[model samples]
Target: MNRVVVVGASAGGLSAAEALRRAGHEGTITLVGDEPQTPYDRPPLSKQLLGGDWEPDRLALRSGPDLDALALELRLGVPATALDPAARSVTLADGVRLEYDALVVATGVRARRLPGTDGVAGVHTLRTLQDALALRARLRAGRRLVVVGGGFLGTEVAAVARGLGVEVTLVEPAPVPLAPAIGEQAGRFLTRLHQENGVRVRVETAVGEVLSAEGAVTGVRLTDASVLPADEVLVAIGCVPNTEWLADSGLTVRDGLFCDEYCGAAPGVYGVGDVARWYNPLFGTDMRVEHRTNASEQAMAVARTLVGPGERRPFAPVPYFWSDQYGTRFQAYGHLRGHDEARVLDSDFAGRRLLVAYRTGDRIAGVLAAGVAPRPLRALRALVAARTPWEAALADPNAG
Candidate 1:
């Protein structure tokens, strides 16, 4: 492969480019991104960046010297408008066509915006750097904020707003926040975590409409017709894949671009990050993970496959993610959904530390730990990857 193109400039695409160079592939590598700025870490956009603890330059994933060393041809601030797999080329927004002998499709997802909030002022969604900067400015003291949805993003935003002394009300239609991902018990635990930090938690409630006054958002009307006044609102329901450009590209794209266990989309083409739904033989299922760890892992695997002949490896990862909020760090590993049982491994009341294990049949399916030091939890990843018995996982901690 003498010419390669890596689309998208986020974690997955950037990792793919770097991995190719590291693998000693002497190819002309081109990295295309929609953002004007250099690749940056996104998880901080909701925490450190939005909380005003970090500056824009601090989020950069690569410095000028770093990119110069890689010698990657960068096409920033221009989005890919269309893809032609048969022609082995991609069309940019400005009508420039980039041909590639191999391609890495890492065009990740975008934030799902709420209806009727597009043109309205005082409404925000935190997906990009600009969004975070604007939101941080509005999170002044004495401001009342309403956050729609109770997912990690919304919950994190609410936590940061409260820390800024902004009165925050987090509304979720589900009885407990993050119940779908972390189970009801753990979700309820997080709900209390936020409430204890001075955030108003409204469970089993949904927003019917955004209430605006004189072309600016004043509040939101609940399903029960009650209104919660707010100086600003953040809609963080979820994200959708940026896969529209691949319409006629002949790649299987439903919720995301479909890939095999090796992250292969088609011949000389691959997918990674939130935009790729790949199968995992270990779990006997297909999943699309948006976490940063999965993105880097998948990209590296794909890059190696592209660089070396017959060096392909299946992308089987022990799913892991971490979130920091209100001075507490929440970490989890493995698949949590469809588990048959859940058990608390450790609960240190004085230390505010808690650990829980999830099991599917006799095998441990997942593990979640809050306020628990990562030094101890690192062992849980290997345990989950090995499909160890839940009893063994519970006992291993005590042995340590």
Candidate 2:
């Protein structure tokens, strides 16, 4: 490819550009980002930045000299407005048209917000650096905060807020937080962890509306008509892929941009990161992982596919993710979603440690561990990678 245009300036897009250079691509690369800031790590936004432990400068993914060495044409703060697959060109909001021989769509996702809460003070969504800074400014000791989702984001924020001496109330629409993503047992464990840290846990409830007065949020009303008085509200229900710019691009776009086993959306066009819902041959399904590691790993894979001399190989990988709450660390390997069974291989609730294995049919689909040593967790991850049979995995002494 003579020219490469990468849409998105975050982890995935920046990784792609860096990998292309490392792979000896001497052609032109144009990186487009809606945010004006240089590429920064996002995982810290919820934990360190929100908790007042880290500043925005500390989130930089690369130093000034390092980024400058890439020789990239950086277009920051201007979002892409449209894409023309036939013309192989992208139109930016600033009316700049960029042509490319290859394209990488890594626009990623945006935090989902509650309805009718726009322009309301004391309401927030933690997706961007600015979002974290704004929310952090509002957090302080004795402040009452209400979090509207039980996913990883909401839970982590709750943990950090609690550490800041803030009173936190977590509201979940499910029977338990993260029961659908993880398992009910693990979810319950997390719920108890939050409670032990002095957070009020509310399950099987939905926020009916954000109660506001004079354009300032006062509290939230639950579906049952119960009101949660709060100084601030964080809506972390989910995220929406940044695909609106590709509406007329003739590429398949639904919940995410559809791609093949090679991450190809069309000849000379590919999708990466959170914006990609690509077929994974290892799992025999199509999925879009929003994890930090996946973004960088997939970007390197796509880079090799683009610049490699040989035939492209199928992009199949054992998915992995992790979360930190209170003082415990939770990590998982392989695909845990849709597993029919989960077996607690080990437990020590008092010590805050556990290892669980998830099964689909006769094979081990995933493994999760909390507060486990790195060496043991690595061994467990291997079992999931091998697709070990359910009984065989249980029989193996080192499986956990």
The runs of at least 3 residues in candidate 2 whose Cα sits more than 4 Å from the true structure, single-residue gaps closed, are: 309-311
Per-residue lDDT tens digits for candidate 2, residues 1-400, read 8899999998999999999999999999999999999899999999988888898899999999999999999999999999998899999999999999999999999999899999999999999999999999999999999999999999999999999999999999999899898899888888998999999999999999999999999999999899999999999999999999999888999799999999999878889899999999887889899998988888899999999949579888888888888878899988888888988888888899988889988988888899887876787778778888889988887876
Collision count for each candidate, in order = 0, 0
User: Each prediction's Cα RMSD?
Assistant: 1.6, 0.9
Q: Which stretches of candidate 1 lie over 4 Å from their true place?
A: 391-400
lDDT of 1 by residue, 304-364 (tens): 8988859777888888888988888888899887888767777764476778788888888
lDDT of 1 at 17: 91
Q: Please list all clashing residue pairs in model 1, or write none if there are none.
A: none
For TM-score, the strongest prediction is 2
By summed lDDT, the worst window of 10 consecutive residues in model 1 runs over: 391-400
Residue 386 of model 2, lDDT score: 85
